[model samples]
Target: MMKSLLNAANFQLLWFACILGGDNWAVAAIVLYLIVHHYFFVESVSEWWVILLFVVLGVFIDGALIFDGWLVMPPSIWTFPIPPPWLLGLWAGVGSLFFHCLSWGLTRPWLLSIGAAVFAPLSYFLGADLAEVSLGRSSIATWALMAFIWFWLMQVGVFTTRLTIRRNGRTHHV
Candidate 1:
């Protein structure tokens, strides 16, 4: 229990560091940590795969947002319209949370939606404050759209885990 809690905290801290600071090296370190930690501690490779899936999905989503001009990243760092390294790192940390910190929300869609509605926009708003990213058109409208996007992402995570369980032919907590 303690270890899980600590891992969860670590994930959040890594996300904050990457997003708020735009630290690429921090993201690299986090990737290393996830690799080593998963090798020894995570129960199965499937969980790691799920994490990868989350990363890919997250990156794609961010790419779409950037492409549509809903979020504006630094032009210098906007290589290929995908989210920058720091945001990709944030996705990795968020991927981990689907199994650990925020796992409880998987079974509670309404709660997850409510949480996402509040916290997702808050994170972006915080990011804006840090000058990492900016709302593309209107701040209020962008935030509302971001809330909906995150809510969908959370729902997809739960659904994906369920699909993984069925395909694996075993019941397991993701």
Candidate 2:
């Protein structure tokens, strides 16, 4: 229980640093640290690969939102044609949490979906407030869409985690 709480705390801190830091080299370092931390301390290499797949999926989905004007990011140091690296790093943190801090949700898809629907949008709103990201002028609609997206995404994560764990000859409880 203590380990779970500490992992969650680390995830939140790293995520905040990435999002609030904007597009900086430190964001890259933070992300690299997150990957290393996950690879060495959190889970096995196979689990890390699964986590990374979700991270990439998140990047593409969020990147689409940024491209479609549903979300906006301010100019940053590592500016590209998509959402900033910090946002991707934020996703990486959240993705990593799926297998560690929030592993209980792996056995409860409905609860995971509901939790994600609420917390995902709330986190995005918090990030918007903390950083230069926003959910556009129609914030409520955007928040609703975000909740909807996360509802399914959480289910997908649950299923993927189960499949990966089972394939690796591990108990699917976590």
Candidate 3:
């Protein structure tokens, strides 16, 4: 089993399954980030935790959205013909993992802020579209504005965290 699992073909197939199962674009973004960072070996503890946390958070956020009726996926899209409660979280995990990976390449606070502002809405829209969620024509613009605000919050949080770490005289690489 271990030998088969270690096969390159098997690994590729597994990644392919993940891509087809959720937001492929977000996954692609993550893969791009990994490639850019030269950390594609999958050996980093921090990287693994980041991926796991993103997925968990996505699931929770999605669950709340479902509970509140803010989002819904039509039955036609699924082979099982019903929206699974865990789907939202799964999507969130995928997206968050992608964004967090991208964050590694972001060295400057302003660049991170702007990049998040632009990519957040695009990522949201792409995820929604992939999941077959209908948000009408104005959804893009509305979500873009919301994404910008959210990006600002994210920037502040990341900036503060980095500052705190720096103040403590800890050396880190981005």
Candidate 4:
């Protein structure tokens, strides 16, 4: 229980690091956070694949939004189309949440969907504002789109993770 709380705090720190630090500030934080997470909090080796899955999903969603002109990111060492690396770091951390801080929500689909719909878009808003990025031509529309995507993402993500994930040689029934 305590570890889950600590993990939640760690995730918040990473979120701030990604937003305030930008890609520049997030490099060390991402590396250190992932290392500590894998060492101390990971419940199963399969969780790494889940992280990869989210990386791809997040990149795809953000990339599609960029292509459709719904989201905009500032210039970075990385080029156009692909999301900035710091954003990828944030996605990885988000994936890691299911096994720890977000575990409680996985079992309650309606609650998870509602919370994700609300908070995920809010996070994007906060991240965009903090990072000084633009949300395409319309912030409201972009946020709504994000809300839709995140609502489905959490619902589907928990479904897939539940079907596949096993912790300590047994399925995580929670």
Candidate 5:
């Protein structure tokens, strides 16, 4: 049982989950800042609530994309034959990590949005390629496109989040 638990695929899945959760945690830092600083104040919404919502949304999006064939995992990783749950977990983990990383930024919303749009895709592709090599999958150009799509999605998420905060009459902190 221990051997099976320590299998390579399982380890990969674990790492992926960590990344997903970590990114989301990072994002939560930003939300916390907004709440404490009163930059994006919403009467009905609390920081924890927004964080939870973002976590759920990120998980759902990741799972849906993987299940729909928009993204492919490494071939050697058969531990997650059922893609949805694995992806959902991974998304949550990675998003948390990202949020943590960007928590202390002083940039404006538009700048942050643009930066995320550009970097997210590049980072996704890098991660994908690393996964592919580790999984021994054939190289494909579609992965590049997948990275671009990821970037676009990240941009949309940031844009929508910012807009929502602004609509609630919150001031931009940076």
Candidate 6:
């Protein structure tokens, strides 16, 4: 319980850093947090795979949104195939939470599903406002689409975690 609290705190700090500090700060925070997390909380290299999976999925999802103009990022050549650098860092943090702070959601996938539908979109909604990223024209419509996408993303998350854990022959960390 105490570990979870700390990890959650770390995640929240990462969120603020990524949203407010942009790409450079996001990279620094992600590196610091992952180093600490790996040294103390991680048991195996399999965890790296989790972060990788999230990165790929996150890029695809957010890239599509950006390409379609649902989410407008700062102009960059990397805008189509990859999302903003800070957002990539943010997704890595979220993936880390699955094994540390929010591992309980593995057993009860519904919690994460519900959270995806409810809180996940709100994060983007709020982050866009703070970071000056645009949510296209209609924030409400974009938010609704985000909600739907996140809910399904959780399905992939749950499946991936289960498959990875089962193959590795261990329960998740934390």
Query: Which prediction has the highest lDDT against the true structure?
Result: 4
lDDT of 4 by residue, 137-174 (tens): 67778778888999898887787677656433555634
Q: Name the candidate, 1 or 6, with the larger lDDT value.
A: 6
What is the per-residue lDDT of model 3 for residues 1-174, given as tens digits with 9 covering 90 to 100?
A: 333233333333333333345543435544553453335334334444444554555555544554455556555323542234334333333333322333452366676667667766675566567556655436756576547665764564455445544565654443
Query: How far is 68's C-alpha from truth in model 6 (Å)?
Result: 0.3
Residue-level lDDT tens digits of model 1 in 96-145: 66656566776796798788888988887887667557678787798788
Deviation from native of the Cα of residue 92 in model 2, angstroms = 1.0
Task: Using TM-score as the measure, name the better of candidate 4 and candidate 6.
Answer: 4
Query: Comparing candidate 2 with candidate 3, which one achieves the higher TM-score?
Result: 2
Q: Write the per-residue lDDT of candidate 2 for residues 15-102, one digit (tens) a residue.
A: 7677666766546656666766665456556677766877788778988998888887776665576567777776767767766767
> RMSD per prediction, one decimal?
2.4, 1.9, 8.8, 1.8, 11.2, 2.0
Better by TM-score, candidate 6 or 2: 6
Q: What is the lDDT of candidate 5?
A: 0.45
Scanning candidate 3 in windows of ten residues, the lowest lDDT window is 1-10
Q: Write the per-residue lDDT of candidate 5 for residues 1-174, one digit (tens) a residue.
A: 333222323324444543453433434443343343233222334333444555577656554666666666554324543443333444433333222233223234455556655665555556655445232223345445545556555555455445545667764332
Runs in model 1 lying further than 4 Å from the true structure: 36-41, 75-78, 169-174
Alpha-carbon runs more than 4 Å astray in model 6? 75-81
Q: For model 3, what is the alpha-carbon lDDT of residue 147?
A: 70
Question: For model 2, how many clashes?
Answer: 0
Model 6 C-alpha lDDT per residue in residues 15-60, reported as the tens digit of each score: 9998998865877888887898788767668778887888888888
Candidate 5 Cα deviation (angstroms), residue 13 = 15
After superposition, which runs of candidate 3 have C-alpha atoms over 4 Å from their true positions? Answer: 1-39, 76-106, 136-174
Clashing pairs in 6: none
Best-to-worst order by TM-score is: 4, 6, 2, 1, 3, 5
TM-score for each predicted model, relative to the true structure: 0.84, 0.90, 0.49, 0.92, 0.44, 0.91
- Highest-scoring model, TM-score: 4
Error of 6 at 170 (Å): 1.6
As for candidate 4, its clashing pairs are none
lDDT of 6 at 133: 89
How does residue 79 of candidate 4 score in lDDT?
75
RMSD of 6: 2.0
